[model samples]
Target: MNNSAQKPGLRERKRRETLQRITDTGLKLFLSQGYEETTLDAIAEASGISRRTFFYYFKSKEEILLAWQSGTGAAIAAAIQEQTADKAPIDAVLDAILSLASQFDANELVAIERLLRSTEELRASKHAKYVQQEGAVFEALCAKWPQARRRDSLRLIAMASMGALRLAVDRWVEEGTKRPLAKHLRETFESLKAELGRQS
Candidate 1:
């Protein structure tokens, strides 16, 4: 795998900037005209990049959506690792997820979620990307607990925590309520924790 950081040069920075511009332009267009209606040529033209350059950054229309999640996954994993270094692995994982959830603007996320729900292809792509992200989070936890044998348990806990956050966000979108996303996410996690404690 090519490490973007180690590939130092002016050209690399220019390439990154171009990719960002293309992605930003494509997202804006997708939001304005539904994702299905937006064309790659229009995105390339809007971003002032050639069609070839656009293809260099992303292979297809669906790939742009995947790219956003992939880019954010790395940041989320790092945030979790940094914030949860001193805590129990499960607590750390939940805290990390909550932190990532807080970064989203509710309206923007609701729109994106609506777009994702509207297409089977997008739903599959998003789910696959999330599975990959879950693996990354699992790896980060394993790094922190190399000798721990309960890997499946930890993964299940992480998935459940993430699922709760997802459901909360979905409810917020569905209700069109004015509550902050972080509050809902935290409440969901807390409720899950209480339920688990009761079962035990």
Candidate 2:
């Protein structure tokens, strides 16, 4: 019985490693040759995996680019729950977003942003994914604040916070600035708060 459980666990670990290898190789190729120019076959060849195997891991090249963020929505939701136990709902969500942003390297994020800007298909797919994640975050926020009955308001707040973070990172990357992502993120949050205060 234990062996049966262990078999599945080991298989899953190996599968995750294979998928990561494919994604890392694909990103490198995409960054070098442009996302559209880098084919799935090239990614498979670079990762030493068959094209069929690559398909088993990801349905398309765009899927591979956004795969990390797929399951991450749920993780973000959970992080918000844990981190915001005693904090205000919006503050908790902002903290979670900042924490999540810290998970990736600055170069990796700049590369991903560049790919999204250059690829219309990826932009559409990424937008859809962001909408889905926004829904998840909204649900989590509602759970945290039972009186927060306005879903649209929560979503707008989430979107605004995300937009601020994206702008900060984009500026940082464009200027070749070297700063911790968390610091940029905190500054973005502070700027948003200040802007809101000015309007009020």
Candidate 1, poorest ten consecutive residues by summed lDDT? 83-92
Every candidate's lDDT: 0.77, 0.77
RMSD of candidates 1 onward, in order: 3.2, 3.9
Task: Give the TM-score comparing model 2 with the true structure, all chains together.
Answer: 0.74
- Pairs of colliding residues, candidate 2: none
Clashing pairs in 1: none
- Cα-based lDDT at residue 1, candidate 2: 62
Model 2, which residues run further than 4 Å from truth? 1-17, 71-75, 143-153, 178-180, 195-200
Range of the 10 consecutive residues with the lowest summed lDDT in candidate 2: 145-154
Q: After aligning candidate 1 to the native by TM-score, how far in Å is the CA of 32 from where it should be?
A: 1.9
State the number of backbone clashes in model 2. 0
Give per-model TM-scores.
0.85, 0.74
Model 1, 44-65: lDDT tens per residue?
Answer: 9999988998888889978877
lDDT tens string, model 2, 1-200? 66776565777989989988987898899889988899989999999999999999899988877875665677778778777467755678778877777787778777777787676787787778777777778777767765646666767776776577567767777766677767777788788878977988
User: Which residues of candidate 1, in runs, are more than 4 Å off?
Assistant: 1-7
